[model samples]
Target: MNILVMMKVTFSTEEEITIEQGEIVQEGISLILNPYDEYALEQAVQVKEVYGGEVTVLSVGPKRYEDTLRTALAMGADRMVLIDDPALMGDEWIVSQAISAFAKKERFDLIFGGQMSIDYASAQMGPRVAVELGIPIVTTILEFTMDGQCAVVHRDMDGYMEKLRVPLPALFTTQQGLNEPRYPTLQNRMRARKKPIVYYIGEDLDFSHEDRQVKTVSQEFFVAPRRSEGKILHGSLADQVKELCDFLRFAIQ
Candidate 1:
């Protein structure tokens, strides 16, 4: 019942973001584990309670991300695998490739991740990795259970329910509606404080390609305008449908 959870550590909203030479200037910014990844981590921990096997937390990012994985360890994953490869920094395809390659090497029976990383909302990374491994990918899984070598999962697709069963060694990237993640208990937090945080460097992994070819570079990074905080579209089911249909009709016309 070995499971692997992929996580990302990101900058908090309170931290100021800047851009220098096209790359995000995150120096001195406070970093935290991706909120969405916490849901995946929570689910994996719950499964650990029943199945009873090692839960390995893995992440591919800059050297600074070790602080983030330590946080996941505090939450209760059994082991950690850090792919310290410089080439993987901020490149989604390479990150997915290197991670999937590493995960396959570990022979984990199940791999779970968040729907997408917060810093980059490209939701295709998980599925893309699964494709690289030639495995089935069930995304947006709200609920799932392991039965022998099979997995029964509940998925939501545009207000419709989708029940699916896939073979073992599959990939799942989930949304937040799946379950509520619990906070680290006092004792666990204390233990986590004493836990060892291992550091790995770029030369550790087998790196074949380093795409140094750059087509363009950015000069700055700025936040987008936040939409209205409230103003529900419509509360009633009928009103919601009417609003949606009217919007669609207007859009088509």
Candidate 2:
């Protein structure tokens, strides 16, 4: 089996949010493999253990993202493919296109990724890549089972469970409850440092001009205004009601 795991590197959870020039400043901030994507990596590793196959992790980010890919390799993934180029950064559509382009050159029985990137939470990449590959997609999978070329998946829709069966060469976006991600051991971490990481630039992929463009543009970003403390109503119920009514009237005005 050939499994490909799509992952993202994002700011560490403890990092403070800092905005600059209408964009989040990442300089000097600690980055790690996206927590949600870790689940996909864990699942891929588990699948590889059971089926005895190669697992490859793919990511689109700067060279720093190699740390994230290394961590995945330490967790038991076989190889890493990195599309490292700042010019390739765009919205979900563009990212998925690049992934699809590279993926078309290789054969994969399964592709996995997080349900949504923690940074954007657009929940579009997996579906978009599925469209580009003309394959079926199962999002937010809670239970996964495979038998030969067929996969049985169970997902949560609202509060109900939905079961589905899809053929090989399918894509899946993992949700939080799917599995517990394993931490990379020190031994594996050291070994991963020696693993080779294949790199590619934007020009390497065949993408149209429109596919490379970012669809959404941010106008501005500012911290939300501080909220005022609640006022204490000290008096009889009638008096308090009267004060509340007056406050409401003033607020509406």
Best by lDDT: 2
TM-score of each: 0.80, 0.91
Model 2 stretches astray by more than 4 angstroms: 208-210, 230-253
List, residue by residue over 1-253, the lDDT tens digit for candidate 1: 8898988888886877876666677788889888888889999998899988888888877777776567788898877777775656545766776677677567888888999878778786788889988889999899988878999999998999999999988989888888898877778777766776544444444545453222334455666777877545767999988988888899799
Cα-based RMSD of candidate 1: 6.4
Q: After superposition, how far is residue 157 of candidate 2 from its true place, in Å?
A: 1.0
lDDT for each residue of candidate 2 in 159-204, tens digit (9 for 90 to 100): 9999999999899999899999998999999999999999998788
Q: Supply candidate 2's per-residue lDDT for 201.
A: 83
